[model samples]
Target: MDKEKLAYFKEKLLKMRSELIDKLQKKYAEAIDIGKGDGLDSADEAYKIYNRNLMLGRVETDALKLRLVEDALKRIENGTYGICISCEEEIEEKRLEYVPFARYCTECKTELEKKGLIRM
Candidate 1:
């Protein structure tokens, strides 16, 4: 990829990273005091537990995405952005546009998925 394109993806990734961090912080704050001693009845307590779990799950997903974005940024620093990590091939621009943090090209991603290597 050209320097201009790389810069574009870097900018997008940075924005995404910032957004994810903000979301994670908000979710963490919400989850921290959830279900505290509030004299809630059993139904309310169940709802609180459900919401906390949902928030925690979303936090985990966001954290994973943040790590991927950071990794893509590192790849940009190393002059390896837009290349598939598994095959060392240039990933298509369209794929990158859809997923700026993609670490593999479509073929390799499918293969890894079939092998149970890629996380859901």
Candidate 2:
């Protein structure tokens, strides 16, 4: 990709990383607060447990996305952004624009999914 496009993607990825970090901090704070003693009946305790599990799942998802964004930034630094890691092909501009963290081109990604090597 051209320098201009690379810069654009870098900026976008940085912004995303920042936003995810902020979200993670907030989520962590919420989790801590939720862990504090909440005197309640069994029903209320069950509900709180469910909510805590849901929050934890969301935090895990966000953390995974943050790692992917960091990896994408590293790829950009190494001048490999916008290239599919699976097939060593240039990923489509549209795909990069939409995902920015994609490690595979559409075809390679599809093949991996079909073979159960990757999930959506």
Candidate 3:
């Protein structure tokens, strides 16, 4: 990729990582008191547990995305951005536009998904 494109993707990845970190911080704050209160009926307890689990799951997903964004930044620094890690081919611009932190092209991503490898 050209310097312009690489710069664009690096900027995008950095912005995304910042936003995700902010969101994750808020989520972690919200999850701090998960199922904390006592004197709750069965229904209330169940609801709290469910909400806690849901929030934790969302945070987990965000954390994973954050890691991907960080890795993409590393790739940019190593002069490997825009190249699919799996196939070593130039990833489609459209796909990169959609997912700036993608490590694989659409074909490889699809194959990985089919093999139950690419979670989220």
Q: Which candidate number would show the highest lDDT if scored against the true structure?
A: 1
Clash pairs detected, candidate 2? none
Order of quality (lDDT): 1, 3, 2
* Every model's TM-score: 0.94, 0.94, 0.94
lDDT of 1 by residue, 37-117 (tens): 598889999999999999899989999999999999999999999999899999999999999999999999999999999
Q: Per-residue error at 51 for model 3, in Å? A: 0.4
Among all windows of 10 consecutive residues in model 1, the one with the lowest summed lDDT is 31-40
| Residue ranges of candidate 3 with Cα displaced over 4 Å | none
Whole-model Cα lDDT of every candidate shown, in order: 0.93, 0.90, 0.92
Task: Report backbone clashes per prediction.
Answer: 0, 0, 0
**Residue 45 lDDT, candidate 3, scale 0-100:** 88
Off by over 4 Å in 1: none
lDDT of 3 by residue, 58-110 (tens): 99999999999999999999998889989999999999999999899999999
Candidate 2: tens digits of C-alpha lDDT, residues 3-120: 9999999999999999999999999788767766568888887877778778888899999999999999999999898999988999999999899988999999999999999764
